[model samples]
Target chain A: MARTILTALVSAAVMGVGSYAASAATLDDVKAKGFVQCGVNTGLAGFAAPNASGDWSGFDVDYCKAIAAAVFGDATKVKYTPLSAKERFPALQSGEVDVLARNTTWSINRDTALGFNFRPVNYYDGQGFMVRKELDVKSALELSGAAVCVQTGTTTELNLADYFKANNLQYNPVVFEKLEEVNAAYDAGRCDVYTTDQSGLYSLRLTLSKPDDHIVLPEIISKEPLAPAVRQGDDQWFDIVSWVHYALVQAEEFGVTQANVEEMKKSANPDVQRFLGVEADSKIGTDLGLTNEWAVNIVKAVGNYGEVFDRNIGAGSPLKIERGLNALWNKGGLQYAPPVR
Target chain B: MAIGVTNVPERSKSSGSIINDPQVRGIFYQAITIIILAALIYWIVDNTVDNLRRANIASGYDFLRSRAGFDVGQSLISFTSDSTYGRALLVGFINTLLVAITGIITATIIGFLVGIGRLSHNWIIAKLSLAYVEVFRNIPPLLVIFFWYSGVLSILPQARDALALPFDIFLSNRGVAFPRPVAGEGAEYTLLAFIIAIAASVFFTRYARQRQLATGERLPVLWTVLGLIIGLPLITFLVTGAPIGFDVPVAGKFNLTGGSVVGPEFMSLFLALSFYTAAFIAEIVRAGIRGVSKGQTEAAHALGIRPSLTTRLVVVPQAMRIIIPPLTSQYLNLTKNSSLAVAIGYADLVAVGGTILNQTGQSIEVVSIWLIVYLSLSLATSLFMNWYNARMALVER
Candidate 1:
């Protein structure tokens, strides 16, 4: 028994030493594996969730597929890890995921202290309050001495308190850790008001027993610029993900739909030709350590930004969210991309 | 010494050397284990440091003092967006304790009744108890929480049309609202009288036990204790001019206008934990009662003791000896399961700690705090239970 135990100890010590010497940046590992592990929110409609057919289809899920197309010529090479709000950052930090495509806000502390670099905002949202219309409350200011339901571990909770304190309102907060609980409390009449991002409010309202009874107050309390994030210390990986999102916006601006992407390769326009992977020697894809057909693959797999948004969250979908801040630059919204070249 | 050895009888000896001795082997094994444990810990620490550096993330607990810039849903103490992360964690700890304590109490009462019902002579009662245990024990706690929060609670009436219960209590899909106490100036005197009544009850219980042992006559101990607990407090309240009033909730145009409200997050978690844990507790209780030999009951009956007296005086005391150890462990399990509060967003320790971790980027610190707090709580509970068990142990002549 003693001899067996000694042998086991020595072998374990050797394995530990070997692993310590072999540790490297997860970005390189993900690149070599030809896939990016993306952490996403679990079952948020239009954000990230599976459909009835067990296939994931959402705005956030598209970002993950786009990154995979950028790295490899196949969008299906990516693995999606559905994580809770509390699990997203930890999964990224522990190297369990290569990128986080969940609808995370870009905050100063999260950027500098958490060792993450966020790309441009994909969704511009604001915290808002929703109350049952039976109360005849048209504005949030009337919610003095009210009981408000807010989700825990979110910016919504902070905004609710700030809005109340600034208005000198004395209110009690009915807090829950998950969005479902907040909605439940609101539906149950445990709270007179429910507060969250406007997009989330729309999605949650649809799940209520009487959707038309609740009215979203006419106030945008806080700026919520939802963006995609990648880990720090991997400039190569960061550039790849950033450019992938930019490509989608650029595609929309140049009128390169998935139906016309094949025909656009023969166009005389230099910018369209380059973005279509047919001009300027196709150097953009090569520079990012991918094949020249990368852009073609992404568009074919997921379509342009407008296509993704309209199908998932726009008027055509259940959420029916308007493209107020997410439209293209020429359309008078904040979404604009630099030249592909 | 050598001269005497020549005259001694020779003994049969094995070929074992001192280095190959069992005692030596045991020591050697212990030394190896210690060395391996130390080396493994060193390697993990080294790897973590290198990884953190490569990721460019700083690791420390200094972030606890940083501004939280976040707010919690339910807090017993005052907090703000500008409160420190430490304060947020304190709020989380209090929330966890509140849910755990309430869950344990409710689970115990339900579990004991169901356990006794399973051993009933009637076939229907036993079958019903069996069905209850099977249904709850088969389902996961998370699903149960969702079932209650969304499936049931969300279907309740609207705030304006709340279902009114007795004593000015209101129920709706949102949660239950109840009348809160409004203490008056003379409340202290009434509280003092209640405490005095409890002391009198304890004294009367001891006196009743001694009277039954010496004179072989029984006293109505239950009635006396009840009167001391309730009647004395009532008299004291009248003498003090009724020192309390109710803050009854009034229905407003939009919502309930006054009194206190309990959120559905807490209600769902409390309900789920109690029902789920009671299933396991019921099984433990049934086994405990069954573990007592049947001969003890028959012997008590042969001594001319009534059936009810045999159960109260002989059967129950013996079954408790078997029940308590397992019962204590079940209570601990319920406390730990309360951490699932993160799922339904009840602001328990794990959920609150998770938020602080995100705001500060201090994963190691936050996880360490969780481990230390939970482990210490477990240890303290175990120690207390051990002491109680020793006091209740049978003493032999």
Candidate 2:
């Protein structure tokens, strides 16, 4: 009965939206709706958590805000849908959300089979492990015969299993469907160790009952390039999301902070002028289906990538994580963008 | 026909107007309804398939052969992350059946006791049973699961400070760890002895019933059956050099090692489901018992039967006729509710299916599999119960 009802509802939705989708672009849909529907993490402290006033403010949240600001010239014009790890992809594929900025990993399987387009790695991360202080375990190699807690439906689960099997070590897995459940289970001594992305481990560790009692290990097992994803087959929409991240990184590379962005519009440098959309007859933003002030709106709304990181999970926030690999290319990092001719 | 009946006129074969004929109208309306229904189904399926194709999303069960890449918390069969998704789902199905079958047995036993207690002449017992039913039946099962998981089990001592029990068992927030029985050489003989003991007990039971009918003397069947089962197994074990040994858990640097552990996730899900379903079953039992007419009990008492024997041999046997049907529904309900194991990470069918769906992006196929599997399970339960109900049904001359 449930299957029949679900199929009916899905088919009805498809029939209603399919013809419109084939004719109209995602931008037009957003324009008609007057708000960019963004999917985000349910809660991850400095990543995408809601404050006491029920307002979302975090690293992933700012990306969606920047998208809304670029499209509508108003950051607050974006609505948020908090999704679990398992619900993120389908929600985007079904047109329930415009873009998924939920710290999702960029993988070939997701990009192709799941019908999502991902580019511009937002955060450079690696899978790591966290163990209790008293466990006296030093490295991931020494975690043999230990019970490890991890969340389901994420790359971390597979990474943990692969890493253990590669090293010929045996470990029991205690998996949960949600992040908070994994946290609670680990905190309750259900598992000796917790495993996830290193950055996630840091943010989630802060939410534990005693943050001082646990320590993240120093082994980087898998490269986890977390990025925002949009539904496949819409090259224009994909380009818009991809370049939004590049614009943030480019703005930071050009030393354009949120406060100095407006002033930088009057700079004599042709590159900076064109990037800020102030150069005469510049069509960079128009070609991407937006106004000349698209970059300006993004900068004004969420600032550059550096500022976003600092304010949310970096030194300006509680996480205090260093800009190890998320820095610009000139500063010894992987964040490099195309020239804004 | 009129000539034969001698009083009534014969009816015509058909109405003058075909539109006015009731049979023709009924068939026409039915045909129209069928056409509309078929058209609607076709439209929905067509649109859904077109949408999936346009979106470039893969929609098939080919991903079942792919590596699952994630480990389950508990599995009855041997499973690893290297196993295929199909094997993982099978493991999940087995886990679900394990919980459901155990929960049904435990709930039935508890339900019978509480149901009988509700009707006890003692005031305290009746009220306590009433309170149990009222409290559990009113609250949702999910909250009960959390209450056991987060509220009760999480507060237990950690692994390093685990509470040790007798027989090398240890209890902690993680789980209860006990000795794993390792069956060595000649262990099959003990299993063979157990099977022989069971067969002998069944034969003895028939013989005892026949002897009672023939000679008017009762045999001690229960004790004899118990002795046969236990003594046979013990004698075989000793004769076979006691080829079973325990790998007792020893406290290690982090946790107890060398033994099998039952995780708290399974424990809490099982406990919560059993308790929650037992309340409804208790009500069913009470209704079934009360449904038996009072004169039946009086009639048994008027005979030479004692009070206890009257309730057991007379009242309970008849009450079972009423009990078995609803009892089947409760069993089905418990089986379905085992899907709630996912909420607590018990690795039941729904939880495992959700993981596989996310990994492979086969939402429609996965949901269809779930629908088919659950329908089969429910149908199987109903069939077995119907067969049992037929046997217990009251026979009339």
Candidate 3:
């Protein structure tokens, strides 16, 4: 009986040596550090890249700015952590970044298995192919036996295979890890096609030696729901990040632009009142441990969801991608948000 | 001499004094070390298991069998997107082996020639070798790969305007395309004959060695072996009607079609590794040769031997004793340096494992595989070098 008790105690001691306590809340860490550590892509034009003045601005950058606005009431309080696709997840897991807003795709393996919580997707995207205009290829189906260039270790690579296999088309893929290398390969005429997200195709084509020489194929191969993600464990911070996305969409649904938000706060509409935090009885901001004026800050910093879309990647930017499927629910698109009240 | 007497009795050892004894203390120290190591290993395994379970990632070798769904730029074996991740890694290993072996052969030849050139009487030849070594040896290998990949190969013309070379060869930015030989019926017989010729050459070499020991006269075994090997293979090919054909590359509207091409990725990696490693090897060769005392060559000349014969017969054997150890290190460095294939997309083991790591979210398993494979390759190389060194060291006696 005594030996059995001693063995149990020793085993318990060994168990304590292996498992560790979870990390502190990301919100608390961010607050204590006075800046949000945001993980972003090394450089993808429409998603995340530095400008001439070395300031980061893009769809993903604006989202991180929105997050910062929600927390600190200041959008410029974010310090970006540029990471490659291969190092992104490990960097998050190692606590080198507070939030990952790198236009990362949400998938089952990344969410449940990789110890992450993906907020709602900010962009609805799909895989497509870009080929030289001289090839006279109009559709992806005409790409049989074509040599395709793709980035390795991406959902785009897998989707390319599935699309080809499903269509019973043959292709030879030239894969590279870096976007620059893939672009160079395609530019050097080593491959006939380059496959990636449609928005990416637009952005990448601009960087090509001859942007006018290529055309994107008219095929949307697979769904790529690009979302922001945070590490698991710390449900409150997850709720804050998740609700920040919903608040932006809800503000857009309520027709709350940055310029009109303050004026809209004086209107008699109760839904808009609660959304803008003009109604003092509203608990949405308090529930997330923020001021009732949080949504106003987000809108002022990066505007509502539609405004963000139109400016960064939609009609205003060089990419000029249309907001077809990314429009609000009432306008025949899929973006729907819950009521702030 | 006077005998001395002691009044005190000799001290006897007690159980408490066992720590003072070297043998007993040695055992105690080793026991402590073993226990500590075992504990550390157990702790690490437990931590990894706990982390993996918490993350809900399935841990096992089962992921290797899943669909890779990715493409490699170059593969030695047949592969497609539908191939398994295990097959992808195998392709990567084959590519690495191809580069390492090919680089070693080319580097050795260039290194020996440059080393000999540096020792030449001509001032121009010696200075040129010195310049070659200094230029390559001081620069990073990664930049060298980029220099060849981007600066040289990427600047070549497009496939539609490929620079045509002799014998159905085409050079472009894509690659160098040459006719691929397709074997026909009865090709197996020729391969069998070639194998037989190699076996015969080995036996002939052993026989010549025995004859030399017995009669103190050496046979012309090098020429005999070369003739048997080449002549036997040639005779078989002719007898079999030389049933082979080439699928020559043809210039097309946009591509040079119907032939195999060596991609620029492979060419850049191969060239960079060979040139970079050859520089260090040349220095080692030069030092090894210079380490041999001048007295040995002079002794050979006093025996009325020609200068060329003295350098080959007397100086070379002694220089090899100093060269083998450092030469093994350079060979190993070249093998490890081949992992830089990722920088230019040649898809070596490290690069392939990196892709799998991201795809499967299996960082631990993939990294462990890389560590084990590189360790095994290094050990196997060192083992072979040790065997060769032992054989050479026997000559000293």
- The candidate scoring highest on lDDT is 2
Q: Which prediction has more favorable TM-score, 1 or 2?
A: 2
Alpha-carbon runs more than 4 Å astray in model 3: A1-24, B1-39, B251-254, B394-396
Q: What's the count of clashing pairs in each model shown?
A: 6, 0, 0
Off by over 4 Å in 2: A1-24, B1-16, B211-217
Clashing residue pairs, candidate 3?
A: none
Report the Cα lDDT for residue B232, model 3. 92
User: Looking at model 1 chain B, which ten-residue stretch has the lowest summed lDDT?
Assistant: B8-17
lDDT of 1 by residue, B1-397 (tens): 9999898654323435767666677899999999999987998676666666655677777777877777676788888877888888999999989988899899988898889999999999999999989999999988888887776565778777889999999987656889999999899888888899999999999999999999989999999999999998899899889979999999875567678877677898999999998998899889988988999999999999999999888887778788889988987888888888877667788888877765566776777798788888778778887887777666566
lDDT by residue for model 3 over B1-397, one digit each (tens)?
2333355344334445766766678888999999999998887677667755654555677889998987776888998878999999999999999999899899988998898788988999999999999999999999999999886556799877889999989998878999999999998888898999999999999999999999988999999999989999889999999977899998764467788989888899999999999998899889989999999898899999999999888888888888888988988999999998887778898788878877887766777787788888888888998888887773533
Q: Using Cα atoms with residue i matched to residue i, what is each candidate's TM-score against the true structure?
A: 0.87, 0.96, 0.92
Residues B127-158, candidate 2: write the lDDT tens digits.
Answer: 99999999999989989999999865557898
Whole-structure CA lDDT of model 2: 0.88
Instruction: Report the lDDT of model 2 for residue A122.
Output: 94
By DockQ: ranked, best first: 2, 1, 3
Instruction: Say which prediction, candidate 2 or candidate 3, comes out ahead on DockQ.
Output: 2
